[model samples]
Target: MTAPSAQTDRFVLDRMPPRDQWPAFRYDLPELRFPDQVNIASRLLDEAVENKGWADRPLLRSPQLTLTYAETRERVDRIAGYLINELKLEPGNRVLLRGGNSIGMALSWLAIVKAGLVAVATMPLLRAAELVQVIDKGQPAAAICDARLLSELELAREKRPGMVRHVVHFGSPDDPQDLGALAARQPPLFRACPTAADDIALLAFTSGTTGMPKAVVHTHRDVLAACECWPRHVLKAAPDDVVTGSPPLAFTFGLGGLLVFPMWAGASVYYPDAPYNPETMVRQMREHGVTTCYTAPTFYRQMAPHAKAIGIPTLRHCVSAGEALPDATRQLWKEATGIEMLDGIGATEMFHIFISSAGAEVKRGAIGKVVPGYQAKVVDDEGREVPRGTIGKLAVIGPTGCRYMEDQRQAKYVHEGWNHPGDAFLQDEEDYFHYQARDDDMIITAGYNVGGPEVEDCLLAHPAVAECGVVGKPDEERGMIIKAVVVLKAGQTGDPAMVKALQDHVKSHIAPYKYPREIEFVTVLPRTETGKLQRFRLRQHTP
Candidate 1:
């Protein structure tokens, strides 16, 4: 057994069955029973074709263009027809897609599914290093990319001869090489290719538990399950609502929130080429009447100070993820927009959020509960369950688990029949799971272990900080001390007083002992392509 002191703060959950409480935060939908064997695109299109059965209902609305389900499906069908009839593609063939979100991207993605080809969508912001890693791993037969980001492909093409064929901008195809023109010329209405439950649908790469990025292979069931379960359980978005948010499409969070979640429900979605700047994102939200928003806790933190400027009058549901949702940010959103930012935590391996609380169960600081279909527990090193409130590795078991096709990272995460991917979570007696931090993100100093995120959360409550990261830096005296690298709000200067003030603020908000020992104020902190803070990079700058 773990130490009794470790169990002291453990929250006890009721052992017996509790009273059944229907989700008050959700809009009732006909309860769904998912089928065993399925293909994602086939299901998405078929549902809109059948149940939603709405003709020409809007399917996508980007900053560049708006497309209806009829328009999108027809074009995707043609593209699928092109891939099958002309490209000679078959189900399960890997196709690399390199670009940001666009109508063409949306169409190509659908086309891959419609043709039964596996999609390897990458973030546009990924550099050649990450690209080469993915290309070498997947060995895709074909690629589609935007014209602007073509140079990286040029670098990749030198190495990945397998990715010889490339798809560029849609226009009058002068002749043989224009995939866009060919797709446009083909007729819509193609039959769905039969696929098995275990067939690979998407291959997403997220940071490995060992620090290297690992490619996670997800099946038709895993990818589609989140799309279906999310809108049903979390967003409650209908065909009438316009959904939009900021996350690179490569990130599963963005894929689900910005594209799949809305489209799966036959609702419209929008994406802009530029960064999700508060001025532009808020403008689009109001102009398009975007009903649902999903983004990082940091994004919300930045938007909070300019809440009214960002136009929150008609906003309905806003969610925070990619980082913990600080109480200050959540309370600020409610004060500014009359809505709380629902907090959720998920990883790329899980595809999307498997743990989230519906709006009604909103706890100020705790991330909600395990999603209904997913089972979670806090466990010790030996896999035995831990008592409530004791922080331990969070393990998940569900319809989805790791199928790390041809990668050693699989064994590193999926252990002893449990998908325990190095996350730390604390569960309460009420079943609410509080995310502690990533396992490696914990810092030990003078025999005390502190979570990086817990300290970062405290500093973010300061008005001077816009975004922050906490990392353990080498200290000969105390072994290791918490250091905060902070980015200030626009027009704010990093003065001596501000650094001291931030430290003082954290001391007051959290355990005084956990205050950042050193403060380095910078204009920006390094982040992953999908906007997650890269603490590894922050540690390099520590003096």
Candidate 2:
């Protein structure tokens, strides 16, 4: 890789992993190779129009509007021009983006990359304190946010004055100073910045389930390489497929599934007018003729009933990730729609999904195989490779891997050449990887090891259970006792009879000892903004 130009700002570059510590990146795959200097937005968006020869094809669609490839390209260029000429943002400056999933957010992300600035995208649900940490850590030069979501960001800015130099708001028609008004004053054409492929493109903050969020640095080549690996091999999306999902664009999952994958396949994506519940998601699929969808396992479980009632005939592909996909949820979705859910595991550090399976390759209970450009293994606690069928830590190396910015945890996350993702798994003789539990999520009761997710899966298979979380509770007799926290479906009572029935159900489904020794019912389970269950919260309530 070539060095960044002298004029390029080096805030993000200076914080990256040292050259010797970086994972071994493979560009031998034809699709993985790129020029020394590449602008991903230009290659994926602008060149897409020139190569496809039909600029009128729809690229982005929402209930409010549908933009053609030509239209999206023009708006992206105008936004790039606005950032460069009006805001005076220099190449390599970090610009924070805060919004729900919307075309404006998508345009800002593409424009940021096109203009050679590092994009720092945040979840809309983050409060002032969380935003302050991101602001202080990234030290972004400017922020472009949705007007509806500006209050928290403003509060954060007050606490850290001068950290972010400029603030621009969009999505409020009444505000004349919004990004839309500013971009309208700029020309619709802007030249793409000549950035080195190694230059950092974005700083993705972890979900902070354990503690303070760590910023994961990814580059232009990293982003494009992610696009090449999974979508090309597993998804195999066509040019006419219409995609929609519930994951926020700020998430790497949503970034790849909703934006990058579709653009690379020359397909279109539909952003819902509002955040979707299961009912709304089903309705949208029926009304918009959605072909592909992306969401989590819990969401698939919730939507199974609604999808059965509302019949999504146009839907073909469904993706489940962000957490382990329980066997019961996968079976329920298949029974309802006859379409198997493609399961994958990815991290912000890797940019997108690296292990996934789709269509006929979908296995019964495994999370598919390693993606084409990646290699994975199960390693013991001491970093030695373990034999098949032995549960151990999952270590991976590929075109993209963990590169935490200026964090000591970087040393812990990567060792030798493998990225340890902190999850335990077992590989079968057929080379299929099965997720067991997070290294921290395992439970030991009466000297027998149990995976909490295995119990949670059994609970989800029960008729009256809507959601559940399992953890180990302190006990004087047994080293630890398996405890379950559950949420009942609507119109179901959380009485002792229901708890007894759930316990009986689990005992019958799996080993009797793995059944929850105690059960508690709640109205809702604590989860992160991206819909990942916070098992730590459940552990706090355990006695």
Candidate 3:
């Protein structure tokens, strides 16, 4: 049963899918328990100083600025005061946040939740059209944006005039509507809203696609539950640990790893002034003494050579998500930096990493066990539990589950009270789950079913291959034929002989029938800004 909500506006509450459509939530873990009325912003920020005794400890840090726990709470309270007193936004109102990963962006997000408003954070790379879709769906009453990324939001507002009434810009000194200026006008202290645990906290939309994204609703309880499960069991972050990552604050992966996880541990996060490349990311980690790093597999792959050349001695925990982690890339990163990569798979639907292993519990090819607070199993098409060693769909349920905002796809995601994330997997006798491919990406040729990731992992082990994506190509002889799109290493040629050698390499490593029958060379692969490979786009490039 859901705790009674304190929000009077009821805008988001009315749009929530019917209670029957919601996935069953479990709070079996002792840490998952929470008070009936809980405010995550207060629980995370204010409690850091009030309860955790981290008043003077550094909370948010960058080369340009550093804010202690008390100072961060002060700024958060001031921004919350501005939103409530100046903008007149009521509880349950949604505020759209736009910016790259920075201290100001973080402050705005925390302030929105603290003010009892739902935060709708958008990716930094979103254009006018994408922003329009977000605006149409979320119907935000106001927006607080980074001044540099304001042009796209301005264009979006032009198309949907009066949709977002109040707009404030941050990161600009000269602008008349600067958020910092307006916020400075408000008092430095404001009492956090007393929100119910079930009240909506944020609306995280799925990215990396052209279609209108689905809005995933997360509550204060959901956010706090995720922090208890993943960070407590898998990450085990320390208070003094300095965290850094490449994911924008918009993505749920970033929200958890970069912001919420750090606050949960009373740790500090370093946000770079500018965007990060392999060179710059390595430099930041080495110079700033970053202890924990969160990024995708592709970024880790690109940074391996750089980390090998320049050491990051303080680095301990490295998290890989946003996409599958190829064992070859994992081996390369481990060889370069002695720290083993903590690979996990999470979705915007589930909020954060639910399947991961760290330290000595790391397995070579599995995505570890179900998180402490969660239960998972591999089930066949009919949603029946598949036998161990059999491949099927992965279903999960815990304190957090799929709760799309009035989307019909809720039925498709939640089946029999479990949240299916659309990934195909197999469970070993020891209960480790091995990822096959995305259910849509599994390739079947001549009655032979092959997992593309297994074949891609095999091809990635070769010396010539730098990056590759495998998919099925429609064929006349067979239903489909395996095709490999590859990006070769520098100084390597992608000629006919090279393709044959790669084919032979895969055939030797795995089943010959699973080898990619056709090979195409490309300079780069299409990927989401968060580093997920767009295999659907790769499959679109047919002969």
| Model 3: residue 167 alpha-carbon error in angstroms | 0.6
Off by over 4 Å in 2: none
Give per-residue CA lDDT, model 1, range 102-180, as digits (tens). 6777778878866767788888877787788888777776777766687887788787664656444442246455566
**Candidate 3 segments exceeding 4 Å error:** 1-3, 174-176, 209-211
TM-score of each: 0.89, 0.98, 0.98
lDDT of 2: 0.89
Q: What's every prediction's RMSD, in angstroms?
A: 9.2, 1.4, 1.2
Which stretch of 10 consecutive residues in model 2 shows the poorest summed lDDT? Answer: 1-10
Q: Name the candidate that leads on TM-score.
A: 3
Q: Which is superior by TM-score, 1 or 2?
A: 2
Better of 2 and 3 by lDDT: 3
Clashing pairs in 3: none
- Please give, for residues 428-488, the per-residue lDDT of candidate 2 as tens digits: 9988888888888889899888889899998998888889999899999998999999999
lDDT of 3 by residue, 106-215 (tens): 99999999989999999999999999999999999999999999899999999999999999989986766688888888998889888999999999999764345899
